[model samples]
Target chain A: MYFLAIGLIYLAVGGDPAGIVALLMASGLGGLIAGFAWHFGRRYGTRVEDLQDSDAPDATGVVGVYPTASLRPIALAFGTTLLVLGVPIGSWMSMIGAAIVASQVLLLVHDTDD
Target chain B: MTTIDRKPSAPTVTLGGDDPNHLVSIDSVIGPSGQEGTGLPTTLVGWLTTTNHKALGVAYFVASLTFLAIGGGLAGIIRAELTSPGQQVVSEQVYNQVFTIHGSVMVFLFAVPFGFGLANYIMPLQIGAPDLAFPRLNAFSFWLYVIGGAVMLFGFAADGGAAPFGWFAYPPLSGASGSPGLGADMWIVAIILTGTSGTLTAVNVIATITMLRTPGMTLFRMPILTWNLLVTAFMVLVVFPVLSGALLMLLADRQFGTKFYVPTDGGSPILWQHLFWFFGHPEVYIVALPFFGVVTEIFPVFARRPVFGYKGLIFATLTIGALSTSVWAHHMFVTGEVVVTFFALTSSLIAIPTGVKVFNWMGSMYGGAITFEAPMKFAIGFLVTFVVGGVTGVMLASPTLDFQLSDSFFVVAHFHYVMGGTVVIALFAGIYFWWPKVTGRMLSERLATWHFWLLMIGFNMTFFFMHLLGREGMPRRVPDYEPISNWELWNQLATAGYVILLISMVPFLIAVVKSLRGPANAGADPWNAYSLEWATTSPPVEHNFEWIPPIRSERPVFDFRWINHDDVGAPGVAEAWMAREGLDDRWLPLAGPVAADVADDANAASSADSDVG
Candidate 1:
C-alpha cells in the first residue's frame, strides 16, 4: 500500500512511468511478505504480547544451558594458520606449527575432556 | 585449568507455560549475562575459552577497535605524506606497506568483525534465544579471524616489510617472481582464515535465525536489523567460499610449485579479477548491510514513530541483497571484459531500492517531532553522503565514465563516502544509540553532538575535493607527485580534511570515558525503542530478559504502547502508552494476547454454527 501510494504521488508530480513500475514491484514484494506471514501463522499458532492482567500458568521452570568451553579448537585453528604462514618462511617453523596442529586436532577429537 | 564438558547444565532450557496473557519470567537458570556459559570460567580465561556468543561479541568489539586505531594511524601517515607534494614523511616502500595494511586492516580486521561483534551480541537476544545455534563454532570462528589477522599483520617484522601489493594483491605483481618475500604468503594465508571464519559465522547466524526464533515470531515479525543480518549472513556463506577457494589457489601457486596466476606458465592474471570481484562486490555490501540495519533500527526510535513502511524496508533490503550478487562485474567495467549494458542497468536499478530507503527515512521524519541528537545527526550525515556517493557510483557504472575515473581519486572519494560515510558513521550511530544499553549510563549528548559536527566537516573536506582531483586525472597509489597542475593545493586540502577527521575522534573518546564513569541510570527503554533489546534492562541480566517479551509485532514495545490505540498517527501515543502499560510497573515475560483473540473468533464462529443447527 505504501509503495502504491508513493507511486501514485510520483505519477501525479511527473510522468515517470518507470518510477510507478518500480514501486508496484515493491508493492508485490510487500504482498509476498503478508502471504508468508499468513502461512506461517496458520502453520504455527501466533504468540501474543504479554498482558500484565493475566494469571500465571501451571508450568514454570528454567533449564538454561551454557556449553562448557574448551581450548582445543582455538589451539588447532591457530596452529594450522601458523603452519600455513610458515610454508614460505622455513622448514623448521613449518614442522613446529604442523606438530602443534596435529597434536591439537587429535586432542580436539580424541580427548573428550580438557 | 579446569576440565569441563559441553553439556547442558542439568535442564538445558527455561520452559515457561505462563498463561498466554501474562509475562513469563525468563531469568531462571541462565547465569548472569556477560558471565561465562555453563562449565566455562568466569575469569579472563573464559574470554579465550568460552563459546558464549556475548563474550565472543565483546572480544570482537575490542579486537576490532584496536585494529581501527591501527588503521586510523596508517591513514594519518598516508595523509601526512600527501600534505605536501613530496614523500617527506616515509619511504616509498614504507608508504606502500602502510596503505596496504590500512586497507586490509580496515576491511578485514575492523569493518567485518565490527559487524560480527554487534551481531553476535544482539542477534540471539533479538530472536529470544540464549546463544547462537552452535556455540563452539562461534568461538572457533572468532579465533580463526584473530589468528589469521595476527599472522597476516606480523609480516611487518618479516625479512621484507609487509605485503606492499594493494589489498586486492593482484596476481603477476603478487606472484612468486614479483613478491618473493614471506609477507605476501602471510597475506594469502590470513585471507583464507578470515574467509573460513566468515563461513563459520554465517552458518551459525543462519541456523539461529531459521530455527531459534521465539514462538510466534514469524519471519516477517523479526526486527529489520535481524533481517539485514540474515541477508548479510547468507551473502557471507555465498561469497566467502569463492574467495577462500581463490585464495587457496593463490596459496598453492605461492607455496608448492604451481602456476595458477603465473603469466608465463599458461596462466592469466586476469582470472584473479573475476574471482576476486565476484566476492568483492558482496563484501562491500557485507560491510554495509548492518549499518543500514542500524540506521533503520535507530531512525524510527528517535523520530518518535514506528518505522515508516516496515514491509517496504525489508523488501528493499532483500532487493539490494539479490542485485548485489549480479552487480559484481560492474566493478570490472573498465576491464572491458564486462557486459556493459547488463551490469550498467542492474547497477542503476539498485538505486531504486536504495532510493526507496532514502525516501522511507524522509517520510519517517516528515511532520514528526525531530530531535537532532548525536545518533540522528550521524544518521543524517550518512544519508546525505550516501546519496552523493551513490550518485557518483551510478555515473561510474557507465563504461565511458568509468574508463576516465578508474583508479583515480574520484573512486577513492566514492568508496570512502560509502565506507567512511555510511559504514563507519553508522557504526558510530550504533555505538551512541546502544551506548546506554551496553553501559548502564547515558553518553554526554553535548560531547556526542560536537563529535558528529566535526566528523561531518572533517570527512567532507577530506574527500569531496578528491572528486575534482580525480576529474583532473590524478591517479591513486602514488606517494609523491610533481607540484604542477595545481594538484598540490587539492592534496593539501584533502590532507587537511584528513587531519580534521582525525581530530574528531577525540571528543568521542572523551565521551566514552565520561559515560563509563558517569552514571548507571539509563533505563531499559531509553529511546522508548521498539525492538526486543529495549525490553530488558540497560545492561541486560544473565538471561537477557527476565521474561521474554511476547513477540507481538516487529515493534514489540511499540505494539505494547499502542495496544489500546484505535487512533493511529497521534502525538499522544507515547504518553497514552506509558499511562496504560505503566499502571503495573513490573514487566512480566511477553506472551500473546493474539492467540486469545484468535480463540475468541473461533468460539464465536462455533456458537453461530450451533445456533444455526
Candidate 2:
C-alpha cells in the first residue's frame, strides 16, 4: 500500500509508469492481507497475543494432525514445475504436465478406506 | 515429561514438581489427561511428510548451507577472475553469469534462508507454542524453498547456463533484446518461485508469531530474536510482494512481450529500479534484523545484564523497518529517477534508529559481568566490522559521494562490512549460541576460537582495504583492470583476504562436523540463558517443551535462577536498591560473583556427569 501510493505520487509528478508493478503489488498483497486477516481474526480472535491463555507446554499435545506419507505432493510439485517450464520449453512437455496433474489430483482425493 | 537435573544444589525444574515461578499450570496444558501429539513417524517417508517444526528447521539449515557452499564457490570463481588484473579465469559472458548467480544465490538462498531456518527452529520454542499455527503450510513452505533453489541452480544446465544480467536482472538488458537466453528466463521463473516460497513462509511466520504465543508470554516478554523475526516477517509481507510483482511484470516483458520496461513502449527501465530497490533496501534489513536479534540475545547472556532499553530497542527495530522502506531510492541515487532529496533524507534517518540499537548493545555489556565466549567473541566482531559498514553507509547516503562511488568497490566494501560481515558473523554467533540447544551437544571452543581469529583478521584484511581501493576509484563487477590503473597491489591484497576467509571457514566447518559426531551431552540451558526456549530440554521434545516456568520477566531462566539461587542476581539487585534507598543490605544474601559463579557450578555439574558416565 505504501509502495502503491509512492508509485502513484511519482507518476503524477512525472516519474513514469512505476504504477504497473506498484498496482500489481497492491492487488497481490491486498488480497493476501484481506484473506489472511479474515482467517486469522476469525480463527484466533484476541487470544493470539495472550500467551498465558494457550495450552500447557506439552510437546506432544496438538489440535490436529492430517494424514501423511502421500506421493501426491511430490507429483504436484513435478507437474507444476514441468508445466511452468513448458511455457518456454515445448507443448509436448505441457501436455505431459497437464496429464500428470490431472491423474495426481484424482489419486490425491481418493480415500484410503479401500 | 523428563526431569532435567540441575546441579545438586540449584533447584531442579522438574515436570511435575511445584515450582514457585511456574508460569502456566500443568493441568491446563501438560497434565496426564492431554493426548500425546501425533509424534513423528519412524520412517523416512514420515520424516519427509512430517510437519514437525524442528525437522523443517533442520532441513532448512542443511539446505541453506549447501546453497552457501555453492554460492561461495561462485564467489571463488569471480575472485579468481579479478585476482590481479587480466581475466585469468572464465570469459566475460560466463563472468557475468557467475557474478549474477553469486549475488542471486547469496541473497535469496544463503542469508535469508539461513535466518528462516534458525527462526523456524527457535521462534515457536521461544514463544512456547506447540507448533506453528499452520504446520502443514510450514512443511509446504520448506519444500517450496527447496524446489525454488533446485530450479534456480538447474538453470546452470541450460544451453546458455544462467542469467548474465545480474540478480536485479534490470530491464532492456534483461529483456529479450539485451540478452536472449533461456537462462535469463529460467532466472526469472526461479526467482518468482523463490519469492513465492518466501511469501508463503512470511505468512506462516507472521501468523505464528501473532497468533500462537503461549499464554503469559506477552509481546513485551517475547525474546529479542522472536521480536526481530516478527518485525522481519512484516517487512517480508510488505516488501516481497513488490519484488514478486516487479519480477512478474519483468517476466511478461521477457517471455510474453509486455513492455513494462522497454522505453519504446513508454516503460522506463527506471521503473524496475524503483520496484526492485523498494523491495531491495528493506530486504537487507530482513536479513540483518535476525542478526540483530541473535546478537541482542547473545550479548545479554554473555554480559550478564538485561538488554539495555528493551522497549527502546523494540521501538528502534520498528523504526528501522519503517525507515528502511523509505530509503530504497538511496540505492537509486545514480539512476537520477528518484527524488534525491527525499531518499538522502530518509537514508540518513536510518542511522538514528540504527545508532540506538548500537548504543543499546554497547550499554548492555557495560556494568555487567561480561564473558568473551565464542558467541560473544563473534558478536563483538560484528559490532566492530558493522560499525565500519554503517559509517561508510552514511557516507554513501550522500548523493554527492554516491555519484563518485556508486559503481565502485566502495559500495561493495560497505555492504560486505554490513551485510556479509554483520549478517554472517551474527549467524555464526547464532549457530554457536544455539548449537548446544539445537543438537544436544556443544561445539569445540578451541576450534571455534581458531575459526573466529582467522575470520576476523581475514575479513578485516579483505574488506577494510576495499574502502581504500574504492577511494582510489576502483570499479566493481569487472573481470579485469589495467595495471596502469594502479589497482594491482590492492586487488591482490583483497584477493588474499578472500583466501583467508575461505581458510577461516574450514575450522568453522570442522567444529560443526566434530560436534555432530561427538557426545550429545549439552544439557538444556547450557549457557543458562534467559529465553523460553532454554527452559525446555536441550534438544527439545517432539513438540517443543514439556512444561514452561512461569514468565516473570523477559529473562525467564535468569529470573528463575534469581528466585531459586538468590546468589547470582537478586542480592545484586537488592544491594543496588539498598544503596540507592540509603538502607542496609542486612536481610540479603551475599551478592556473589554472578555469571562466573553459576558457570563454575554448571561446569562442575558437567564434569561430575562425565565422571559418572
Best candidate (score: DockQ): 2
Global lDDT of model 1:
0.73
What are the per-residue Cα lDDT tens digits for candidate 2 across B1-613?
A: 1111111111133422476444322222222312243244567887677667787787788888889889989988987787787878899999999989999998898889888897778898888765666665677677767777787787778888888888878888998899788888778777776777777788888877776666556788898889989888878887887888888888788778998899998988988888898889989999999889999999999998888999999999998987787678788888777778767887999999999999999999999999888999999999998899999999999999999998899988998899887777888898899998888799989998999999888888778888888899888888878885558777777778889989999898898899999997777777868888886666776666555554545776665445434454423322322232211111111112342344455457768988999
Q: Model 2's CAPRI class?
A: incorrect
Q: After the best TM-score superposition of candidate 2, give how far the Cα of residue B119 lies from its true spot, in angstroms.
A: 2.4
Q: After superposition, how far is residue B86 of candidate 2 from its true place, in Å?
A: 1.4
Question: Candidate 1 on B255-322: residue-level lDDT in tens?
Answer: 78688788789876767776777678879889988888888888888888778888999999888876
Which candidate leads in lDDT? 2
What's each prediction's TM-score? 0.81, 0.84
C-alpha DockQ of every model? 0.13, 0.19
The candidate that wins on TM-score is 2
Off by over 4 Å in 2: A1-45, A48-75, A94-114, B1-47, B565-613
